[model samples]
Each structure stands twice: as structure tokens, then as C-alpha cells.
Target: MSRGNRWARSLILLVILPHLCIEIYCSKPDPFAAKKKRMSEKVRQMFYHGYDNYMMHAFPHDELKPLTKTFTNSLSELGNLKLEHLSEKYNGSALTLIESLSSLAILGNHTEFEKGVLWLSENLTFDVDARVNLFECNIRVLGGLVSAHILATDSTNRLTKGTYKSQLLNLATELGERFLPAFNTPTGLPYAWINLKYGVMENETTETSTSGCGSLILEMGALSRLTGDPRFEFAALRALRKLWSMRSSLNLLGTILDVETGEWIEYSSGIGAGVDSFYEYVLKAHLLFGREEMWRMFQLAYIAVQKYFRYGTWYHDSDMRTGRATYWQLTSLQAFWPGLQVLVGDVTAANSSHREFYHVWQKFGLLPERYLLDHQMVHPTERYYPLRPELSESTFYLYQATKDPWYLEVGEAIVDSLNLHTRVEGGFASVRDVTTMELEDHQHSFFLSETCKYLFLLYDDSFLVNKNYVFTTEGHPLPILHSWHERLPEAYIPSNWTSIKGEEPKRASAMSMQICPASMHNCIHGNVQLESVCHIPDARDDHRCLSDEDCGVDSTSCRRRLCSMAGYCGQWRYH
Candidate 1:
């Protein structure tokens, strides 16, 4: 009885044990997957809500006045902060519709995207007698049109033959031709404002932001590539090259410049609104046009920005000539720095900066336009929170680069914040002031183009599969074509993202890898293994050492410094 009973019990126990193990391993449905799907749908609905409302009330206007269920011809009014010189006869260029074109394609609404494309091609014109900010017009209207054109004619897209005759390209070319006059200054740098119908307006302001003249290369260059007319690209490149030549010895450019004189006007500058895209564009221009010159410019400029403006992951305005900190403040636009950094493989610094921006966002339920870091309070006058997409844009890039669940969580927080505070029956409204959560009537076109697009991409990036893109400052995506690139940057290669670490990293260098200067900005957060090789000192105090014995470990990142190169200590190589 003992032998038979024992044999039966042992067999039964083995069978049950294996079944129990399988159950335990597969018990929980993946939380991240669920959240990703749920957040993706939420974002999709958010897009349609705003999109439908804009169509309903503001279809042919520049922007929706959501609070009034009306529209604003905000194009000429965009950078005209004083609302000066707005034409009484001005009509909208279907600004919101153009902005939504590429976004609709990204969201996989080809039918609706096609509809908007046809409408624009047939109806919209830049011929209105309106004075517009050259920079804003280029990034928003020109960027939007060029991007949507590419998407419209993409091999993967649907635009039945003959139905599309490169009409958008024609419109873009006409608009681009108009932009050429602004570049006819004594200096190649374009005027800050131009009249669409008559060209550069009489006595138009000679002053322009560095970004105004510097950021046109992408859209204009792409227009050249598509049109086979070098005028557009040549004009943009002339301006950019001229602007670069104007950089201070520190590789810095000021916030404002005089196009006619080729002289800097306002020398205090930061990587915020006035000068932000100048940095973003150079690197992306290299990627898109395969220009080695752009790559070199971007590399030197980035190092200078890191060395001077960056303080423990935060960047402040500095005298371009002196490299002395000028304005110790954070503008919401600075949130784009992390995302820009991600494109060039500066993830560690990017992560650290992104977290700081998110912390501020959490504090206000939105990022105010300006926060004076010295006083630790919002700027008294610049207290509004426009529906900016920078934080979400960076969040998307970080998630793509790292596959971290945390970025998805950040996107979730952003989506929830928009829904809770900004959503209105008309559309999403801007925060007039973060302190009171008071709302404004205007709905920015980027609220649809960048903010919603990035959050949606963060949660669902199927469109990015098998393709690489560099987003314009306004959040319009232009594919990084193989022909456009020389030898592709390793960063542009599609990663096998089944694992978090992705493909084996390229040969490490201070700029190519994340070995940040240890003086500030955590070199690698949550990277216990990385800590061993991440030391880069704030200063060089020692002479050449031929052996590893000369150098020691770093305290902050738990690094091991070594001696190898320079007839000096290169001991523990961080990269």
C-alpha cells in the first residue's frame, strides 16, 4: 500500500507543480502595454476633438478662438506681439488646416488628410495683403506645407494619380519665391517680417531673431530638393552660413540681430524661443541634407552651449560674447532642449533636464512661459502657458531612444493635464496664466500639430517603424531620406527595440556618448553599471601620466579615472 500510494502521489505532485509555475509566470497582463494602448486611444480622441472643433468654427481662419466658438486671423498677428499692422482686409490661409495635414497622416487618417490637402491646394493662397513674421511663417506655414506635400506624395500614401499634380509643391514654391525677397538685404539674413503679396514691406523691422534667419534651412532646403530649384536652398543656406559666420568666439549667437547691418542687436541669448531652433536646425540639417558643414557647426555650438549655458541640467541666458550668465530663468520653450539633445545621443543629460522640466510642470499643472530661477517664482509678466508641445516632443524622443516606461508615464501626465484643464467645447484653450489656471480664447495650431502628435507618438509609434525622421521645430516631420543623408548617422538607424538597451552602441566619444562633464547634470541616472566609466572632471589639474596608477575614481558617479593618452592620465576611459 505504501509503494503504490507514494508513486501515485509523486506523479500527481509533479504535474500540479509545473501547471502552477506556468500560471504564476503569466499572471499579470503587462501594465505598460495596457497603459500604452489606453493612453494612445485617449490621445487619438483628444486630437479629433480639437480637429473637429477647428473645422466646425475656424476652418478657414488662422486659429480658433475656442472660448468664443469663433476664429482669429492670427497669422499676421503671430509675432506681432503688439498686434500692430494687422490688415483689416486680411483673410486666413486656412492656417489650422495646413498645420493639421501632416498630423492627420501620422494618425493614419489618409482620407481626411487627403480631403484637407485638396482643399488647401484649390483654395488657400499666400497672396493676402498681410505682413507676417518671416520666421513664424517659415516654420509654421512653409514647414507645414512642405511636410504635408511629402506625406501626400509618399510611396506608402494614397493620392490617386492625376488627382495630385504636385499642387502643394507649386503653392510652396510660390510662397518660397515670396520669401526670397526678404533675403535680398545688404546682409543675406532675411528681414524679420515680410508682406506676402508685395514682398518685404516698406520700413519692415530690420531686427530678427537668430532663429528667424537661421532655422529656414530645413523647410527651404527640402523645398529645393523637391522642386530641383536651388534658389530656395541657396537662400536659406546663405542666411545660415552668414549667421554662423557671425557667431562669437564662443560659438554663440545673440537673441536678436539686424538683417540689414549683419550686426547683433540684443546680445543676451539663451536656448529658448529667440535662439532655440538655431541649435535644433543645424543638427537636423546635417541629417537631412548630409552637409558636413552643418554637422561641424552643430557640434561646436553644442559643446559651447553645454559648457556655458548649462548649469546642472538647466540652461540660462548668457552674454554671447562673454559667456557670463545673464538671465537666470526657465522658459517653457527650453523644454525642447532635452528632446533636441536626444537626437544626438546625449540621453543622460537629456533625461536629467527633462525631469527638471517635468517637475516644474507638475508644480504648475502646466509649464508657464517663464520662471525666474533666481526668485524661484513665475515671471510676473510672462506668466501665460501657451499650449506648447516641447515637453511632449522630448518625451516622445526619449521614449524612442530608451524605451523607458517612465517617459510614457510623463506623456500620460501631460495628456491628463490637457484634458482636465484646457479642453473646451470649442477646442483646447491656452492658459492665460498658470497661477490661476485662467484660460484664453486662442487655440494655437501647434496644439494640434506638435502637442497632440507627440503625445500620441509616445504611446503608439507604429508610423515610425522602418523609418527615421527629424521633426522641424514646429513639430512637422520630414523623413530622413537615405539619398539626402551621406552615410547615415548611427543614431538614425532603426533600432531593434525589443530590449531597452537596443543595439550595441557605437564607438564612445564625449559628444557621441553620454559621458557628461561631472561638474553638473547627473551623467547617468539609475545606471549603477555605467557609474564605473562615467567620470569627466570639471577641470584638468594633473600633468601627463603614462600609467593607470596616476588616476583615481570620481566621487559623484563612482567613476574610475585612468591614465592612457596625452602623455597624461586618460586612465579610466568613461566612453
Candidate 2:
């Protein structure tokens, strides 16, 4: 009774099985979709909460004392440990508004972004009697203005349609001019501080961090490109070149140097506060401005960093001159390294380091300003969590690379913690003490510029579709244009070599440039396939090698090349 009917049913089921499978596999509802949408909105509200407060209480000031519902003209005080020479008459520059511009665009608040742009255009001025830290001003103010100007004028910026003049650009140019006076030092390296009103202050201190001397390239370079000035770019580049030249033979830069004498004053350095952005700019400068020079420098510098500073999943402060670990501590700022590593296609390494940071974040409920890695405790006095964005910034980049939901969870935790502990009746405040969860009155401009922006992008990245941008140290977005890029360096050839020959030459992969030997692993570099990463660099005559990597791989035998103390690579030795 059922044989023919069953056969017909089976045939029907078979016909539709493939169709059902396609829908189930391809069109299944995204599991994280609802959660991500919810998280994105939460971040949006966080941004608005802080921004609304700043507008109310700190509208014209550099930052908000959210706890006090007051304002602080913090620009001049940035990087000034002693907060010296802060002008009482320096009312404000609407600094928080400038910092929030790109964040507004990223969050799709065109109306607010446009309003802020117009207000800043009309009201902001740099001619105050205030003295400012040059590096801080360049990254936060100049970078912000230039980015907002680009966004305000871009064809896609629907909010500013037909109502825009190049007001922001003109403002940025004026600010860039002010910065030029600081670079007038004999070394072409800029003074760390400058008086916004009178240029460099009389007998201004000449000592500056490595970053102070080297991190200006991106913002200043973008200023030059947008304004056609070339002065800003040249000044920044000259300083960077002089800074690089001052690096030790290990290719590691020190913590502090004297701009006037072009001499290193503080020899200890690592990829943290005093020197982080310098390393960041070298890689990013190559991407943004198409300079092959920065890439070459980054390769050597990266190798040195990996060799000397990196140990397992953490990096400790090291003596740049000697390539020895000097300070075994984890800094909140160092959290940005994972993101940089991701950009370099070292995702595996990035992930490892990111998880370690997440572990520390879980331990403290916030990343302290410093944690003694060896002691496994917070630094005695450096235990404050200023609500920096570096951890979230790295999480966003790692999520972008892998599309892994775990990063979303990491972001969710960050959002929850920020809302739970930092949020106040007015706006988010800094943690003056992580141990007590005590809040500080001041809200940093970067809290708006980077923290919320990175968290928002982590959950919602539609703003990035079909666009390539390099975010400055201040988290301002600068588009990467084909017109701004130069061609990759030419391929390496062995045609003229007297010794060895092997497979066809390929374009040198910067990630493969190693100054020391390591366990080999793979990493990404565009569409170009690279050798197992951490390969020995090419052996060249007169090349001094401290380890086996400097000797490079044997071309014909593909054997390990050895280095002699005489700074030459020798052939493989038979056992």
C-alpha cells in the first residue's frame, strides 16, 4: 500500500534537500547580528553621553572635568607632568569638539558632525597665549582638524552638502605654520614645547621623547598634502630622518633626546609611551604617503624590536643602545602593539598578545597605566587607568582581521566596564586608582577620539566599506589615495652575485626581513606570498651580523648561513 507513495515522497524530499541546505547554510540568520547591533547602539550612546556633557560643561575647553561638571584647558598641559606654563587666559579651543569630529562621522552622526565642523570653523583659533606640547597638539589638534576637513568636504559627506567652505583646512594650515617655528632648531628636530602665541618660548626646554621628535610625520604630512604647503611635511620628515639617524646600531631609538644638540639623553626605550608612535608612524607613513624609505626603516626597526623587546607574548622596555631588557612592565599604551602587529600580517602573534592583554584587563577590570610584569602587580604609583583606547583599538583591528566573535565579546566587556565603573552623572572620568576604582575629574580628549571610536568600529564597521584609511596616533582617519602611494621597491635579483643562485627572485617581503633568527611562521602581506616569516635577510658584503639571521639563507643550498664577527656571511659548514 505504501511502496509507490513512499518512493514518490523520497523523490520529492531529494529534489528540495539541496535547496533547503543552501538556505540553511548560506542565509542562516547571523548569530551575532542582534548582539552586535545592540553593542553598536550602546557605544553610540556612550559617545553621546560624554560628548553631550563636554558640550554642556566643556564646550570651548580642551577637556571636561566630568566629575566636577567643569572644564579644563588641558592642551597646554598634555605631556606636561608638572602642568607648568598653563595660561590662565587660555579659555579654550573647543578641543573636545575637534577630537569628536571623526568619531561623529564614524558613528553616522552627520548632522552633529556638520554642526561641530561649522562651529569649530567659526570659533576655534590657535593664536591664544597658551603654550602647548608640540607632539600632543600635532596629533590631537592638527590631525583632528585635517581629518574633519576631509570628511566635511568628501563627496560622501551628505550633511555638509553645498554649505561647506574649506574653513577647517585653513585652520589646520594656520596651526601647521605655528608648528614650523618649533622645527627651526639647528637639528631640524622640533622643540617639545612651543608657545602658541609667540612661537617657541624663550629658553624653552630642548629635551623631547623619541615620539615627540618623530611622531609628527602623519598629521603634518597630511597637512602638507591637503594644503599644498609642503613645509609641514618637510619639517616632519626632516625631524624623523634626523631621529632615525640617531638610532643605535640595533636600529632601536631611545626614550628621549635633545632637539638642539641632536643627542640622545635618555637611552632606555620600548614600544610604549615615550616611543610607541615613532614605530607606528614608520609603518603607517609608508602606507599613507607612499614612501619606500619608511618601509625600509620599519623593517629593520621591527626586526630589532622582535629581537630585543619581544619575549613570548609581551614586550618590555629595553635599552635601545644595547638591545637589553631594561623595564619588565606592561603599560596600557603598549596594548596598541597587537593592532600594529595585525596590520603587519602577524595575526597569530597579534592574537596571542591580544589575549594576554585581555587577561590583564580581566584581572584589573581596567588596564593600569603600568603593571610590573616581573612582580605581577600594579606599579606602586602608576596604577591609574586613564581610560585609554589602545586596548579597544587593538581589539577592533584584530576583529577586522579575523571576524572572530571573541573580539566582539572582548569589546562587549570593555563597553560594560566603561559604563559600569567610569560613567558618571556628567561624563566618563578617568580612574585615578585602579585598586580603588576612584575617578579623576578630567576626561581626556582621546577618550572621545579613540576609545569610543574604536569600540564603535569594532561592532559596526560599515563606515570602512570600500575605503582604505590610515588612522593617526590620535585616531583621526586619513584616506589612502592611489595618488599618495609610490610603487613597491623592485624585486631582489642575484644575477650579479659571485656565489649563490636559486629560485626566481621575488619582491622583498618586509615581514621576512629579520635581523635575528626565530622559529619560522607564516604571515600575510597583501596578495603576495612570502617565505616562512622571520627569514634571514639577504646576505650582503660588509653587512655586520650579530646573530645568524644577518647571514641569511643560502641561495643555492637553501642552507642556514653563518655570520662571522668580521661582519660577513660565510657559506654553510659541513658537520
Candidate 3:
């Protein structure tokens, strides 16, 4: 061959080699894709394993006694802290099946979801003599039914296409009507426990938790929207307003209250069992219904909580009137607060609390029911781990927000922990004692409804791809359709807070195309920068600051502002 031909061939090789290397780099399979698929399947199997066992051993009952390999008629016993109201004649209304309906849909088991819906529509009744907790029933049964009905009717799912009716909605409406009698008191606060068959039970306890009264709006409002009946939403809204009005001057709420007198029964409150869902529902109701009033309420309440309840990464109970610290402890349910913070674009604060919660989960095999922060020990009696989904739920939300692979690792660790310590032959059981890792007799319905569902979504979130959904506190998904509400209002800063006018709110949502905090800017959705609506620029001039707090967060980037050496707020350096 000629020397010129050899030189030309060498030049061609150089160009081809560089292109080949670029292709190789770009074409490499996503490391997480296969692992995510595997985890997704693992979650699917875990869900079905528990679900199949519930079908076999606890069909029609409220929950599975995994340890006993039997059933417990537990609907009436739920929230019965004293176990005082077990009804002998009350038959199971297929509580586990109701709870499992939306899970089945999430797992892509449309056939089973359809079958479950049909069976429930035909057989279930709220007429039994069982006295049930209003909160539990609304969230689990009514929320589940409404969610499943929406899924059934949604064309995307292609579920129950030809045979579909509004059966679930009908049942939900019936349950909502039964709930109405509980709201008949002069104060508009519903009783905590009400007999489904008899209406508010004679001489029923007048006392209820803040959450018990305040968290009813989302489910009931959805019911009113779906059925076009105003009573359910009206009752719930009135109760929420009345409860907000009852807040102490510090804008703090007590743990427990009297339904009839509209008075605080337990003046100390924290972001735990008694009051946690109240905060959750208010914000979520705003997202779900696009109600400006709800957003305003949530903004004030959220700020108040941050000012009083927060202590670095840990939150302690405080007196409602004085905002003085009361109880220095951590409950498993408090884990959900971080997820809420993330939704509001407070990613920095959310990450801080999330790490602490994950540390506790790592310390124990799973999250214990209560950990006393001051003593750095598990609460003496409340040491059980109830297969609660709060940690996993938060992890999923954080992953959606940041798309950080580390959050996926956190989820993987959670899945492994649950399988290792909680999975029983019959189903996943709760830990009777986290210290001993002793299995409890029962698996709560929320395990299927929320725990497995959130874990599965962490891996494969295709279900959320094009949909706008706000998950009910029970983890049931409700679609956010602009057509359903009168108008979807954008969040705005109160006139007192800002002098800026007509600025659009910035984009700030995890994955769903939903409403975000008023101040959130340039939300990143699927790696695409979508412009935010009603954006609020930082009011400070030149980003100058003396303290870290003065260096407020960046509105568009959702990044924390750092104090530069020159004493001005600037973007934090990754290093």
C-alpha cells in the first residue's frame, strides 16, 4: 500500500475511536435501572405475599394476625387505645380488602383490584353495630374506596372498563353520610368514636385528638366533590376552621380537645400521634382542593411549628399557650414531617431531619414507636415497631425531590430491614418489641395501604409520570384535576410579608404537577426546568447577610444561601 493511503487510514481510525468512546460512555446502562427493577419486583412480591396471606387467613377481617396465622376483627378495635370497645356481634367488613384495593392498582394488578372492588361493592356494609374511630374509618375505608373508584374510572388504568359503575363512590358516600351524625354537635367537632350502625354512640367519649377533628377535610372534601353533595365537605371545613380558631395565641394546638365544648383537653402538643396528621391534611387539602384558605392556614401553622416545635433536627412537644418545651421525645410518625418539609421546598431542613430519622432506623432494626430524645433511649413501654410507612414515605418523597441515588439506597436499606425483621410466613407482622424483635400477632392495614405502596413507587414511579396526585394520609392517591375544583388558585405571600407585586409562584413540586409553596422558584421536573407560577423573589437586596439565617434560601434553585467570606449570601459550594 502507498504511504498516503496509510496516513489517511490512520486519520480515519482516530476519528472513529473518539466517536466509539463517546458512544460507549453514553450507552452504558443506568446502574440503577436494573437494581430499581429488582427492588420494584421485590416490593410487588412483598405486597402480594401479605395480600395473599390476608386473603387466605383473614379474609373479610380488618387485619391479619401474622404470628397467630389467624384473623382478628379489628376494625372496631382500631384507635381503641384501651381495647375497651371490641364488638362481639360486629362482623368484618373486609377492611384489609378495602385497604388493599389501591395497593393492588399500584402494583399493576388490575384484575385483582377489579375483583376486590366488585366484592366490596356487593358485600361490604357500614351498618354493623361496630363503633369505629372516625379518623381511621374515613382515611382507610372511605379514602381507599374513593381512590380505587378514581383508578377504576381513570382511562389510563384500563381497569373495570366495561363493567365499571360508581360502586365504590356509592359506598364512600354511604360511609360519609353515616359520619354526618358525628358532626351534629354545636361545636362542629365530630366525636372520635362513632357506631356505624347506631350513629354517634350514646354517651360516647366527648374527647378527641387534634388530628381526629382536623384531618377529616381531605377525604370528606373529595367525597363532596365526587358526589356533588356539599354536606360532607361543609362539615369537615367547619370543623377544620373551628379547630384552627381554637389554636392558642402562639398558634400552637393542644394534643387533645373536647368535641362538644370546643375546648382544649390536653394543652401540650407536638408533631406526633395526636396532632401530626392535622398539619399534614391542611397542607395536602390545599394541594388537593386548590383552596387559598387552606394554603394560608398551612403557611401560618407551618411557620409557627418551625418556630416553636423545632430544636435543631429534633422536635419536642411544647405547651400550646407558652410554646415552652414539654416532652423531649421522637415518635415514628414524626418521620413524616420531613417529607412534608420537602414538599414545601425546605429541602435543607428536610434533609437534616431525614438523616436523623434514618439514623434511628439504622440503630434499631426498624423504627421503634417512640425514642426519648433527652435520654437517648427508647420509651420504656412504647418500644414496638408497627410496620409504619412514615420513614419509607419520606424517603420516597426526598428521592423524588432530589433524584439523589443515595435516597434510593436508603429505600433499599428500608426494604431489606423490613424483610429481614418483619416478614413472617403468613404476612409481614409488626414488632411487638423492637428491642427483642419479637413479632406482633397483627399486621396493620396501613402496611399494605401505605408501606408497600411507597416502597414500590420508590423503584418504579411510572404510575405518577403524567398524573397530578396528592396522596391521602393513608397513602391513597387522589388525582388533582383542575376541572373538579372551582379554580386552582396559586399560592401567594400575604400582603404583610412582601411589597413585591404580581410575581408568579415558582415551580416547586417533587414529580407530580401539583401546587407548591408560595415562594418556590424554578422547579426541576424530570430534569426539565419548568417555569414556576406566582414566583416570589427574595426580598433582600444584593443577597447580603450577617448570619446564616439572614442568608435565606434561593427561591428558584431551592438551594441554601451561604455566607460568603465577604459577608454576603451566595450559593453554597458543593465542595
Model 3 segments beyond 4 Å from truth? 1-29, 162-164, 487-575
Please state every model's RMSD to the true fold in angstroms: 12.2, 11.0, 10.2
TM-score of each: 0.82, 0.83, 0.83
Estimate the lDDT of model 2: 0.78
Whole-model Cα lDDT of every candidate shown, in order:
0.77, 0.78, 0.78
Better of 1 and 2 by lDDT: 2
lDDT of 2 by residue, 242-359 (tens): 8988989888999988888998998988899989998899988987886767877787887777667776557888888777679999999999997887666545456767887889
Model 3 residue 569 lDDT score = 53
Backbone clash count, each prediction separately = 9, 0, 7
Which lDDT tens digits does candidate 3 get at residues 1-575?
22211222222211101111112233557668988999999999999889999999999888899878899888899978798766899878899899988888878887888889888878888888888999999999999999889999998888786463488889999999999999999898999998898898777899999999999988998888888787888789879888998999878899999999998879999899999999899877877776656666776677667667766557889899988889999999999987787566555456667888999999987999999999999999999998999999988876665555788899999999999999989999999888899888889999999999999998988787667688889999988778665521223223442323454664433323443322233346567564321212233333344545434444356555566677665556321
Local lDDT at 187 for model 2: 88
The Cα error of candidate 3 at residue 535, in Å, is 16
